[model samples]
Target: MNPGLHPSKVTAQFEPLIAAFPDWHWEIRNLTIEGDYLALHLRVTGTHRGTFQGVEPTGCRVTTSQFTLYHLVDGKFADVWDLVDTNSVIEQIEQGKAVL
Candidate 1:
């Protein structure tokens, strides 16, 4: 999560992406749990149907990776760290290729 942004504002950031990739889907590639921590590796797939990141829709399919870690306290999330490969997604979209 970005330090400057509130957690509640995080979901709003995805609204543009949701509109751009209406059919986007996430697939869990790996999941692990250790003590109070949970980690996940995910693959995301979608088609560029609307503008995103200042790029106009090209109707190209795109795939990207995301990794996330969560710290649990009393069975609830206390902290979260997340990463997404936005560069790869942009490159694929610009090249008009589907990396899937």
Candidate 2:
């Protein structure tokens, strides 16, 4: 939903976030670079503001860390993947477990 992301990749990347949590916001806690990929060691904290992937918001605060790997090809991202603890976040938000 911004100018920084590649036009082609934007929709794919944004959809998951929008669907999972409509008001999701992110912060970069750390980063690492390897060859053609940049690994974003991120810290994300926000409210479960909307429905995401069939999960309804619990109106709770949750924080989690994730490493997102983006591989660039020909000046555009060829692939985007991440290792995130979504279950932990869900546990914290819905089950009252502490996360972050």
Candidate 3:
């Protein structure tokens, strides 16, 4: 789904996840910039405390990694691409791993 340039649409995509992971935190692991392009590596952690996509809270401490690339034009973001390790999140919830 393309969230496009609309702020509400962009917020909609994460509203549920945010509600589900109220204590979520994103830690930037690495960042690199060259000209108009930028890349980032991050570690995200949170506790499952609310429903996400109909999946009930597992009360598990979830940790996942993500990578993102951005292209800027005139100092404004022109494009963005990302990769998130969602499998790790699913696995932790499915495996019944409790708080860390």
Error of 2 at 38 (Å): 1.3
Q: Mind giving the per-residue lDDT tens digits that candidate 2 earns over 31-90?
A: 888787888888877777676556687777778888898887766677778887888887
lDDT of 2 at 62: 79
Model 1 misplaced stretches (Cα beyond 4 Å): 1-10
Please list all clashing residue pairs in model 3, or write none if there are none: none
Model 3, span 9-89: residue lDDT tens: 568977877899999888999999999789999999999888765668889889889898988776666678889887777
- Comparing 1 with 2 on lDDT, the higher-scoring candidate is 1
Q: Would you list the rank order by TM-score, best first?
A: 1, 3, 2
C-alpha lDDT values of all predictions: 0.86, 0.73, 0.80
After superposition on all C-alphas, the RMSD of every candidate to the true structure, in Å, is: 3.4, 4.6, 3.3
lDDT of 1 by residue, 1-100 (tens): 3234356666886788889998988899999999989999999999999998888999999999999998877776777799989898889888889764
